[model samples]
Target chain A: MTEPALGGGGLVDRHVAFVAALRGAGLPVSMAESLDATQAMAAVDLRSREQLRAAYAAAVVKRAAHRATFDRLFDLWWPPAIGDGEPIHDEGSPDAESLEEVEPADLDAIRKMLRDALRDVLLTGDDEALRRLARQAVSGLGRADNQPGRQSWFTYRVLRALSPETLMASLLEAVLAGEERGGLAEKVARQMLTERIRQFEEAVEAEVRRRLAEDRGVEAISKTAVKPLIEQVDFLRASRDEIAELRRKVYPLARRLATRLTAKRRLGRSGRLDVRRTVRASLSSGGVPLTTIHKPHKPHKPELVVLCDVSGSVAAFAHFTVLLAFALREQFAKVRVFAFVDTCDEVTSFFDHGDDVVDALARMSREADVVWFDGHSDYGHSFEVFNQKWSDAVTPKTSLLILGDARNNYRAQSVPALRSIARHARHAFWLNPEPKQYWGSGDSAATAYGDVIPMIECRNAGQLQEFVEAILPI
Target chain B: MPLFTSPDDVRTRLAATGYLADDAIATTVFLADALGKPLLVEGPAGTGKTELAKAVATAADAGLVRLQCYEGLDEARALYEWNYRKQLLRIQAAGDGQKWEETHDDIFSEEFLLPRPLLTAIRQSEPTVLLVDETDKADVEVEGLLLEVLSDFQVTVPELGTIVAIRKPFVVLTSNATRELSEALKRRCLFLHVDYPDAEREKAIVLSRVPEVPAALAEQLVRTVRTLRALELKKAPSIAESIDWARTLVALGLDTLDETVVAQTLGVVLKHASDHTRAAKELGLN
Candidate 1:
């Protein structure tokens, strides 16, 4: 492909294409914004790539969540190919000599070599020596000529070369042979050797993966490198790492919402002329108009009661939703959070004294009076308990938020309990992390609960944010 | 006269006013001034959204008209309101001498009108900077009011007729991205998102704002702040707060940002107690 020209006209065309690419990536960019970006580009110094990228980002990208996608697309569009030449040099052939050195004829010789390399290092706990041996084993055993998709093959070979299993066998053999005979030294040495062997295997595997990544072209690696952006990640299917990332993003999201809410609250007073006061003051000036008075508009701070299902299936969603609600506690006059699995319990006090939502959730799961360690999720029972014990918590002024999958495990779903709560609350909403397709599937009472409370599909952070902004008192 | 001739000019002028403008910010500000379009700046708090408007006002030697937006913000507060007491006085004064038509005309004249920030900015004949701080905080209805002033730089009073701008003011609207602003409002303005500065730029900011801060200490402070930001804290220290931290360190006679000093003075950078405990734990202070 021909490189786009770097002049004004060329840059504008490149920008248009770049915007198209952004749009293809699911980022919203209007034609007007594209034109504004073209105008913004003129004021930016084309010589500096960082400046150009920032200018485009500022002019085009709207939401923070889209930034990662924007950056990736920017790099692809503007390759930055000048000074940064291709650095990956293909090692055409694996060194035969090093391969032969590691390929011993007998398992005995392999065992001897492993023992020699690790014995002293394990006894003395020398991390540097252990690392060097790991690198040597990885290079010696990991053949570079393996097929493109055989990365696991290299990792397996490197692990076998380190021979953690063999090392464990030898250590066991030594201990059984009574080398240190019932002494604490023997026990400690055995423990140290076991830990060191595991580390050695892990290091060798990591080295192999690093080399494999290098073997692939930059484009291939980058394609896999771009994570499912947080906004798009399905909360129901998110991994532990993705969930952690989502948790980190929650605070900033809540803070932005809070700032907007606070600004709204501060501006809550209407500027309608207080005619009564204005007229009363005019009387002092002999009924002549002098100063106009404005009535201060007092914003109603909604009382929030969040009912979250903290069961195994929907705990991740509950964790994030609860964290966001607590973070925005200032926007409401009162906020009460309840977590339930089979039994319902008020967990608002856990967050009352601390800002660590995760820590508080952990404490609630372990020590809260309402939680039972049993894994079953009974929405009917939980709602019944809530109605019997905490019915007074929901008032006509309260905005009741229920965060759960509404899975009743094919048990009784007391829709009346939910209806009563909804009747007492000003507004009630159920945010289900499950997609709409799965809403009424096996064990899901979402359809039944839907009749009493409106259920919003909140399968991701983006949807959750939209729900919050929509429901938040203006 | 245009406030900025080019992007570089924007940077230099803004830097002269003690506010460091990044390339994106400089370019956006320059284009906004050149095109006479309102600039919509959205970012996290303490990233210098409001400061940019102040810098532009200083650089152009223009009068700064600020309207702090919030929910329930009405046109009367943002635009103009007739001085009721003054109008009443005029009506009482003209009661016997003039007809109802003449008195009604007199009450709605310029003398009886109290101009708010939007109207004041439009009325200024000289160079002026109009800052609508935290526009996202205002109700959605406020965006409708702003659309008229921003699009045509004019306001219409029922009795007085449409009053167009004598000299269009440099308009800057800031938001914390609290809520998605109306699409129509976003379309009328040039958008800019001013995120936290990078390490090198942050160091420059600290040095410029708090000159008394030693260079080495400032670097350490900025590094710590960056590290703190990486943690999942409720509120990360903004650049302004980072500068304040550097100043705090200088004033306390602490030449270094060792663990103890940081542990003690982290409050300057981190506002929440939970944040303090978390940072202290992360830094191995406890």
Candidate 2:
């Protein structure tokens, strides 16, 4: 029942600072949750870092999406120090000289030694040796002289130099030696080898980050090393790896959005008369309707008409928008997806009932009548074409969503064409994948469009989700 | 007030029931028990979310009341509901002389009250573990009901009155992250994310669950299951499935996990045809 005073009164300050760091990383840590975290930290053995780590994670994190960020921030704030004091290596400590003497300068020799040590760790499951090897790999191969803001780069160097991925086959072969061609065994061994390699890489990365935190202070190291959650990464600027991660998140995002929309729909209930049920129930109340129960309202799913600018720069944004709308097609009464470049075309037919999404996107790009005169993004001309072809597209029941950067190539922005569609639609919103500050710059027809339709700067999946929720009618 | 003496006690008790608790789990469980807050466990499917609730019930030697949530799960199913059919029959049986208030009072009495999982858990004076399984699968409105029940450990029927818990039950909610739970509900609970256990822990689990399986065979089976989990399969082999695989190996008296043995018994682990094909291709099995 007694709260553990973590190292004599430092736990309070440490916990507060750690929480502030988590909040800074975009994980919402409310005041009540912070108190819960403090209590959780008090409940555990304060000396055990893992116990405290679990405590903070269980208390502060409300969902699974924030766990990775929580972990990274936890590491930065509550670092694993060697002793009572933080492991500060200033004034030419023997750590440098001893590391140099123990580790070889030759990359090839260090690699060989790493391969052998890693093999031993994997085979024997020696966690102690693995941690030592991670440190060794960083000191020998990564080898940076306390450079500011270079921990990730150093970690990358260590992983590349060690190349544990290449050591997978050899390690597996070594572990399962003389055990014949066991197809499943070899396969499991290979994956196990891969798993160990990943662990080593993670350890080295964590080690480098820890050292940098010890040297440069947690604040400085944290800002540079901790990656923003993948959902927070900007769509226009996300790397291929980040994009792949974002792709994996698409279905879950769609499901959550659907759940919320369903909830929202349920809240906006207006029951209609079901005379059969009402009259049938009235017989029990002596021919008098006491409750007057109306029919359960059939959800009035809205119609959606999406015009996506699938051109050069905004293609990734459009791709995501289209895929999201595709996943949420059931929520809408009808969804007519139109893709455009210099010209416009309704690609709704491209997304057939059972077709693969990636193939459909590819076929839509290849076959759709999106290009009339040139390959340049002529949003003005595209808008006119859409206005001409799909005159009946935007009914009063429809919510119109336009996805683009609004870069009209200095061409005539046919504002009236979009204005006509917006006037007919129940709701209209334009999602610009650029920052709002850059909206009215250069050939952007953002302001012109903004006069007609509400333009939202949706830079990432997170922002996209927020914008979608807003557009869904109550 | 403590269900467990310490974090070590949590580990020991949970381990005695064939459920291993790492320091993190032990600490979180201990804190949840000490603070008298509901514990919310989130994870991928088959990582033992449901089993954790069961194991904690065993550890605490309490009665387990489980609410398996799904879409359209309403208050009538989750909480208390009046026996409407019985109420209707009672209303019909009450002839013209019966007063409205009298019939209403009789129908709303304890004899006519249908107590669901939530109401049952709250009404328990004995030690109890209330499990809301797959909490994310339930509709959002259900969460508002849960928030009220969990925060105060009480339920109200308008006809009768609010009934508070004599002894506060240990509450555990598990979710597969199908949808994000409301913040109001999450705020009342301590969160725990249980991921797939590492190879060593999984091997130990397999050994404990199916002791007839050899140590060497258990190791191989765990490694293989881990590999399948690492693959981009439709449904990865879960801890429970891994235990089943171990039992299958034991029953077959297969000690060595070799090419022929695995080829014959691959069905024991992977269920999906596509997963089988993909595993064969990825693992380079002829």
Candidate 3:
């Protein structure tokens, strides 16, 4: 029942460190919030760790996404001391007795045992036997040392012990050895076995990580341990693998953005009753006000015109920008997408065919005549094409979004064409994938365009998300 | 000046009004009351964000001033607005006797001012709970108005002077986190997130709320709900839905939550057609 060493001064110091840890985990905790939390701690009893943790969380954490990290840091600082007295087992450590019990020979025996068990399950389609074998594989091969980076090692060992390749090979042999009529059934059984084995492998991996999280803390688990890597990936310099990963995350990001925009739009519709209008209308019936009219606050969903530079220099940046625009197309009243390098062409039909963005981008690259397949980017020529043919598309209700590096290859700046488009559109914003210091260097004409349209630096997903949230009508 | 002296006091008082607050909830509520700052509660829908406000109001024996925030929630609707009709009538009744300047000041007086929930809560002599539900649904511009009111506990009317609170009301703003709130507004408040309760807590909730239901049935119902939540359904069942499911079981005179009974009453828990099909299939009800 005694207090754990923390007097009045130490309590404030502990709270300060907890706040620092939350900020380290990427939650923005300002000095004012830290002061508020210290005051909140003073109001609560430090004897109760739960009370102190709640007070600090209530004062410091703002976003729901930061709650998990806050909880982890809180538990680390204020380890519960009461009824939950279970010591850290450290059974997964190399020096532990459990490691000696799981010898290399036992692992080899487990691999063979798993292959035979899976072969029997595949032949008989026994669900119970498959579950039992999955459990055994996890227990036998999922042991780990105290090393922080050994989680994946254990995962790889478990999957290797399951021996999905040998199981598949055996199934193929059985299928080919059977008679022609029975061969078809054996093939179907082999496909089913392949799926079940894949599930079994995943189950073992999940069980190992779950146990490790219990022993070494959830922060030790790799996937959830690291913050999203895509958020920090530079858009302009992203490799093909990084681009693919970013593309996979784009739809979910777009969906979340769209949901917020939709909620704001829906809520804009209903406000207080328009009493003046209702009273005016009720004068015909002796001012009874039979039906009331609420004030209309419907938001105008702006028409979007996306001009993406698909030249070889910024093709990766354009790909992601175009994908995001099309993913969020439903939030706009109308969307027109154009890709340009040396000439401009309306590529809106690429997105209109209801295909996935990746497939649509692939098709646009193959068939769209917007770019002459020239490696050089000429802003003047593309702007001339847009001004000559697509000038009518830039109405006052449209939001013109230009995505490019704004490098002009030292060609004509075409400031007038951009100025005219900005004048015609409701709002014109240029999102440059390049950093700000390089905006006016070399052949980049970003400074000239900035004089015409406000340019925003969007070098990664985080900046791009901020721009979208700011521009989307709320 | 604190409403509750301790966290235990918050728990006991809130429990008297049918709210079973955990240690976290109780502590946060108590600290917010003590600090006299607005409590910003964010969570998934039906996780007792709004219920916390109601319970606090009941426990404090205070009048509840409810303001439902949405897009286009301006100062006129949220804080205060001049009664235009009454003002016009006053102008016509003046009969051209007074000067225009004199009459202008008269029409913008206290009698012509209509107080909204924000103003009403501040002007009250007695303690009150101001519930601003779904604050994130309101426009970003409305956050400006909230910041003005929450920071100084006052409203500025250009026609008149600023109206400060005679007695500061306890404020609770709930959001589903549809959008990120401005940092300036968030800094002026205390934050709480009410997630889905764990199985043991949820079971205790069912037992307390639906007391007529047997202990065994309540445990079974909570287990089924936990399993249903683990499935990737369109919408997960909330704490309110769990309570409703428990009530439905008790009302049907069923003492046991067997597979068939749960299958028949799944509608009370799963609202969507897709969720029903998925839960039934996953539970092997088919």
What are the TM values for chain B, all candidates?
Answer: 0.97, 0.94, 0.97
Q: Which candidate is the best by TM-score?
A: 2
For all candidates, the clash counts are 15, 0, 0
Regions more than 4 Å wrong, model 3: A1-9, A81-256, A259-329, A332-474, B96-105
In candidate 3, the residue pairs with backbone N, CA or C atoms under 3 Å apart (3 or more residues apart, or in different chains) clash, namely none
lDDT of 1 at B235: 80
lDDT of 2 by residue, A1-474 (tens): 122312223657777777887888788989999998888877787777788888888889987878887787787677655312223433354433444554365668767766677778877776756876787667677766455755332788887776777766667778888775556667787777777777777788887877666655677777776787777888889887676567556667888888887766666665787888888898875677765756666776789989999887888889888888877888888888999999999999887463455557779999999988888899889888888988788899998999999998899999998898799988888999999999989999999999999999899998999988877655
lDDT (0 to 1) per candidate: 0.77, 0.81, 0.78
Docking class of 3: incorrect
| Runs with alpha carbons beyond 4 Å of true place in candidate 1 | A1-13, A42-48, A82-232, A239-245, A248-307, A327-336, A342-346, A369-402, A406-430, A440-456, A465-474, B70-72, B83-113, B157-161
Clashing pairs in 2: none
TM-score-wise, the better of 2 and 3 is: 2
lDDT of 3: 0.78
Fnat of each prediction? 0.37, 0.73, 0.49
For candidate 2, the docking band is medium
Candidate 1, backbone clash total: 15
Estimate, for each residue in B73-129, the C-alpha lDDT of model 1 and write its tens digit: 888899998787687667767758788988877777889889999999999999999
